[model samples]
Target: MLASFDIGALGHSFWALTISGLTYGSIYALVAVGYTLVYGVLRLINFAHSEIFMLGMFGQYAALMMFGFAPQGDAYDMGVAQTLMYLGLAMIGGMVVSGAAAVGLERVAYRPLRRRGAPALVFLITAIGASFVLQEFVHFVLPKLTNNTLGGLNAQQPIRLVSPSTQFTIFGATVTNVDIAIVVSALALAFATDRFINGTKFGRGIRSVAQDPVTATLMGVSRERVIMLTFLIGGVLAGAAALLYTLRVPNGIIYNGGFILGIKAFCAAVLGGIGNLRGALLGGLLLGVMEMYGQTVFGNEWRDVVAFVVLVLVLMFRPTGILGESLGRARA
Candidate 1:
């Protein structure tokens, strides 16, 4: 047990928790970058992002359930190539499903009200309410589709992905197949997003519209398309993050787990400066590293306090966040 406080304990804690913090921070930064992107262009919090993450988890789980229910449920049926194919399919499917859900929510729930000239307050509440509605909708639909009273499948079952006897040592740490998969997948996403945003017409449009909606409109940039695409891309990223999170936790997906992580990502966005893409990455990494060590030193009970403390300090020193962009600033 940790004795309230000990100055001499700090050094030991720092050494032990350094690696832990970096790993956790990388994930945090990746997720926060999603929030920064959506908010940078739209200026709306997208309160439902956490729920979108939750949706991704459910979607992936549903896909996995379907696979398990098939006759080839046994791992034996999958050769090396086939296993890779299934993973790719599952992740892509989950992301697509989540992106579609976000798009649908924006169109059906948020767009109509915005079109009617609703107050920002009304918009904010609507966003929050929309999150609840989505959560309820998922809960309502899952049981009907799966017919498994206890959340469709047994998530507690030990996950045996690559092989039973597959483990490697890296820097005195055991690296499992799952870890390799997560690192590779996250890197792939990072690379893809970099290319898509900087090398594509759609990305050009997104930036143009973000800079000046009226001018972008005059230049033939469709605000609607940009907004829609933003939501879609954000949804996809959140979906991918959800998959990574589950692999890390391994205890199965909880319906509301997204809220906390969502908030953390949002904080990360704010830390890096909301509109700055690279800043989100940096802030998330810093936050994750700080949080890891804080928990190690102070125990799990103060993890949140540590996160908030970092936020407060960052805000105090750099109110515009690490990227020097203010998330709360008015756009349009």
Candidate 2:
């Protein structure tokens, strides 16, 4: 039961849940955009995106371990410069590693089947199988291969990279230290992505390839390269999501926790309309607000149920989702 429903704790918990849901939904949107991006061009859901996210988390953990995650109490006096440097390295390492793994998954798993003209249903099966394989990969193979079981995974004091004890209030919502970090970080990423897709030459190449691969190739666009970069960007986004999510929850054991979020995120993407970035963001933000508001009205225990309930209702009314574009077409 959420203390929010009780008058004594109402404001704090309500606002906490509200901001928490927004942060989660934003992270989910990042993962969902991956699914939508791949689906946009290939018309296939890259269910392995969850694995990409999982690996991203693990990748950062690995780097953190290498750099020595700060000790508990006297982690004091850690310079902002050092902290930022470590965070930057972890993020870059996570993104690059995850992006590489994503591409590898594409080339190794799907590309051959696609070449053989595998049916969409078969591809669906492959996606599921890929997911399970990835789960197993993280659970057993990665440990065995590296000969190092990740310690302190569920430790009480999970690492916090950038913690500014600055709180703010807005629209009856209380924002916390991590809340600001998550929101600002996500906004920055989103803004940069907008600029990249709208301003850069490579972005146009991606758009061209996405709209029509054959036509793009005829017009001197490298379909292969664009597809590769699409996955790269997808992986990068998943990595970004990993940092935000890891900081929020802080104590997940298995790497594939991204699976749950990925499912919800993919749902969000479809709810808004797959292949539409703006739609993905809109659906994610709306879904977040709905989830938090639902928790506020009911109890936090019903958050997931509430979210899906709203989604079901929305789908019942607009079966093609809010933006009304089905499958590959970008929705308005």
lDDT, candidate 2, 1-332, per-residue tens:
44455444546567666777888778877777788778876778888888888888887767776887743423334687987788788887678778888898888888888779899988888988988898877766776676645522233335666554548877676777777777678767866775676578987877776777788899999877777888888889888878777766666536567677778888888878787776677778778777777766777787787778878888899886787553223322
Candidate 1 ranges beyond 4 A from true positions? 1-3, 6-16, 69-79, 149-171, 326-332
- Which candidate comes out best when scored by TM-score? 2
TM-scores of all predicted structures? 0.85, 0.87
For residues 1-332, could you state the per-residue lDDT of candidate 1 as single tens digits? 56455445556556435545555566666677677777767777777887888788776656665677231222344688977766666677669877888788789877897789787777678778988777666556665665643233334232333443336754555656665666567666756875666668987777777777788899998988988998888888777876676666645465566778878888888888886666777787788878877766677778877898999999999998976763223221
